[model samples]
Target chain A: MKSLLTQPIFSFFVTIGLFYFFKIIYTKYPFALLNPVMLSVITLILYLKSFQIPYEEYFEGAKVISFFLGPAVVALAVPLHEQMVEIKKRKSPLLISVGVASIIGVLAAAGIAHALGASSEVVASIAPKSVTAPIAMGIAQKINGIPSLTTAIVIATGILGAVLGPGFLRLCGIKDPLAFGFAMGSASHGIGTARALEEGELQGSVAGLAMALNGVATATVTPFLIKLFF
Target chain B: MIESLFFLFCFLILGEFISTLLTLPIPGSVIGMVLLTVALEFNIVKAETVKPSSKILLNNLSLLFIPPGVGLMVYFNIINEYFLPIVISYFVSTFAVLYISGIIVQRLDRS
Candidate 1:
């Protein structure tokens, strides 16, 4: 059985099969907490745990899936590149908005966490929660917070921002494409960018730009914010 | 499809190896991104080679987050302890950033 697991095609189809099963639940239920990724992962983990399947055994296939993240992010550059003309025209505004949003995100999250009686570590971990996972982890680690916890917070933040951003933007009276894109990117990262893409190409491109800029901005700002606070 | 999968696996293994060598504080995926960027810049790899696999992976990027999110189940105590403040602060701040930044950018564009 273990030897049979080494077949790449078998592993590939099995993972996809698992993903399809959860994707259905995700579509049918649409619960915030029951996010497709979260659901699929839980299902996979539980299946492995119950069957005494080691992570190594599962990773044989899962790693193939994970490997594609790099090129995926790079491909984002295509949509973004296509929007270069608009991006150049609005470059300054985009930069300023992303910068301000990053600072506000760090301050707002940290301040509220502190206000609600969270430990210093918890407060700090959530400070960079809006950025992508890798950068968020680095920011968290830099400020002496737990990287694992920071990853969790960042994912939750991304999902919430993605799910709620459009309705919230309408509520806030933001209808401009560039404005919508920047706000979603700054607030949510990739998940929100996905939502933005579905809305329109221009919005998606701007959101992609925002996601990259947010990564850069939060990385630069969070350390400074940490210094200012401590 | 098979060839695309092979190239992707190689890219990931290379990324993992590079990540292990580097002392950067970021995740391997981020490092992998950087590595991919450099490879593209130098023409060590063409965008076409990675495009197909990357497309499929990124389209379903949200799926990757599931395991870690479920890991939150283990941290229920920590979450419960900080639930109110975290939720309130995170959402309020998120919305504020969206609203304020949108206004600021639009204003700047006009000015």
Candidate 2:
């Protein structure tokens, strides 16, 4: 049984099967903490570690899925296209808000991490944690951070934002759907957008726009921002 | 389907080329995304050419994240050591972005 499961194909099957499996559970429960990414990552890690399987072995099958992340990043252009009318009508405000958030997102995370002595690489990694994983990984590499660690922190940041962002916004008396969406996308990326979609259409599209825009904004700003922290 | 992916890959490669040429801090995938958006806007690449493929990838974007997330296992010790700093920064930064961005957009949007 152990040998059968270690086959490269098993990793592929298990990853996809586990993700959708948790996704189904999320749909049924709709609990923020029950995020599919978090659940799937935890279960897969336990599986790999307990069985003494190396990450490289698991990655062999998984890399095929991972390669799609690149094309998917490009594909994000499509949603930005679909949301153009909304993005255009409110262009300046949307751009301004995302710009400010992008800066704060980096400074706040990296600043706190630095002050607490998270080491050079951790500071750099956490700086781009709020951006989507693909873009965040890229920014991490250029900024002298660990790309893989950035990937994990990016996912964790998304789950944190999805679970808490809405409630936090409401507590602050933010009622507009666009505000909610922009906050979610800029702070949490795609996972936050998924949670935004459950609220309404306006929130969903705006969040998608924010996610794409924040990726660019954060990538552009990080090189400059790290100077302040480092 | 193949056509959509083919066009997307072209843009992806183009993005990497530009990033390398200019020494931009941004990633090739990001540069590619921006180029793709512009191309679609200018009618250089028909929107229909990429829509279907984009849909499938976007729908499973989280799935694409798993392989890397799984790699987090290797860094478990580091994450454990810096747990407090990581947690504090995660909460504080995420909420800061959320509250401030939401308010900024709201006030500026209405005006």
Candidate 3:
């Protein structure tokens, strides 16, 4: 009973501690596969498995983290608001980029899934995997995709994009902060936008723009794609 | 802090109810976000009340997924069963977005 009562507190601190630890390792090694979020999650999962801790117990505190997701999403408006003028100026191009990218992303994922003979459900799950969770889950639920599966896929994609996007941009000779930022946001969503912010203000600002546009585009287009493809 | 949490809670529930009634394609939390965004846009909700809690929440957003991802344990043994398809889908789709959108953004930048 004492352990049960203290579980939430323990889990919360464990998460924080693990994150900082992973950050330290990430700084030293800088491996793409050892992304902070990825490493932290793997660490937590391993801890749980080794201890044979039940998920419900672990989630007691973790769900507290989720309760904040709504506000976190709302907070995204801050960066978006700060970048409003530039976003307004390039609204047309931004919309086009997001719309085209989102559609192509869906088709490419779905196409490959079909080619690989993936179950229809797996195809649907991947369809919205690039979008953030709430939207990804919505897309999944709509098209008979597995919502849980989509959530996992979405997080992995976000982390990967956040970690690798900047390096990829540099490799491609794209140095414009706005371009780099927007590309990351459009391709990766919030996680990528967060990473872009770390790169610089200009990158962060434009990345925020991309994140907002991507969300809107994915939400609007997901339903349409489900109909057209399936 | 507690009051702000309650306000967000009520707002989320309200957003869920409205979206559900309309059978909107958007998810409840997203609708909640849009609602809050609009409220902020119109000055209905003061930033002071909203910003504090939102920051705390947003800063730790990545942590939220850990619990869900742990569910992967159930399918650990069969992970490879779907490995090829998931990998192919993830890469192809991601690359598609990158290539096509990259071109469009480049063109727009030129213009």
Candidate 4:
């Protein structure tokens, strides 16, 4: 039993199984709190804890899935490419909105963390919370924060942005899909873009563009912000 | 499909290579994204060639984020201590960014 559990393949299977199980539940219920990533993380942690298995062992296998994140991020260009027509139409406004949102997102997160008495390390981790996990983790490390903590915060931020963004957009009477998707992706990253995809192709494309641009914008600006503020 | 995936991997590798050479703080994958976007825009790479694989990958992009997220368990102690601040910052900041961005972009779109 010990050998079987320790096998790297075992960890791989478990991660995929748990994710799919939670994904099914999320699809059936479709509730904000039933977020698949959140649920899968909880379930996996509990499973390992109950069995007395170490996290390092589990991550050894699970890292295989994580390896794909780079290429997956690169894949965002396809949608951005497909939507070039609309993008070309309003290049200046789109770039301006993404730039403003990126700055505001990082500042707002770090500011809130500082105001709430979080340590500087925690504030740095929160600074990249709006970007996707991979880029957020990289920025967190560069800015002298714990990458693991940044990953958690980034994921939590994504889930929260997805849950709240659309409703708030409606409340603000923002019906344009470009505006809606860009805001969602800017605030939430990949998960928010996933939700945007549900709305339509154009929305999804713009969201993908926003997610990628925000990642670049956040990376470029976060170091300066940390130097000045934190 | 195979060719498209191959192109993506190649671009990813090239992006990593350039990023390391330049010592840029930006992630290579994002650099790869920009590279690919330029390629498509300039007709260096046809959109259809990459579209299928890109769609499959992006659609399941959230799944790839799980391993790092689960790594959170290792930091439970620090997180527990900072729970209130973390939760508050996440909620307040996310809402503020979303609301502000949406409003600004919407107004810009109308203009």
lDDT of 3 by residue, B7-99 (tens): 566667777787789976555665565666567667787656766666566555556555655555654543467899888788667655655
Best by lDDT: 2
Q: What are the chain A TM-scores for all the models, listed individually?
A: 0.81, 0.84, 0.88, 0.85
Candidate 4 lDDT at B11 equals: 91
The candidate 3 chain A region of ten consecutive residues with least summed lDDT is A73-82
Lowest summed lDDT window (length 10), candidate 4 chain A: A156-165
Ten-residue region with minimum lDDT total, candidate 1 chain A? A73-82
Off by over 4 Å in 4: none
Q: Report, for every candidate in turn, its global Cα lDDT versus the true structure.
A: 0.71, 0.85, 0.70, 0.84
Query: Which ranges of candidate 1 are over 4 A from the true structure?
Result: A1-64, B1-51
**Chain A agreement with the truth for model 1, given as TM-score:** 0.81
**What is candidate 3's lDDT per residue for A1-230, written digit by digit as tens?**
54853488887888778877887898799876777777787788888888888777888877776666665555555455555666677677767888888888887887788788888888888888777776778788888988878877777677778777777766776666666778887777767766676676556657656665676688778778877876
Top candidate, metric TM-score: 4
Alpha-carbon RMSD to native, per candidate: 4.9, 2.6, 3.3, 2.2
| TM-score of model number 3 | 0.84
Error of 4 at B105 (Å): 1.3
Task: Give the clashing residue pairs of candidate 4, or none.
Answer: none
Calculate candidate 2's fnat.
0.80
Number of the candidate with higher DockQ, 1 or 4 = 4
Weakest 10 consecutive residues of candidate 1 chain B by summed lDDT: B65-74
Candidate 2: DockQ? 0.65
Q: What is the lDDT of residue A169 in candidate 1?
A: 87
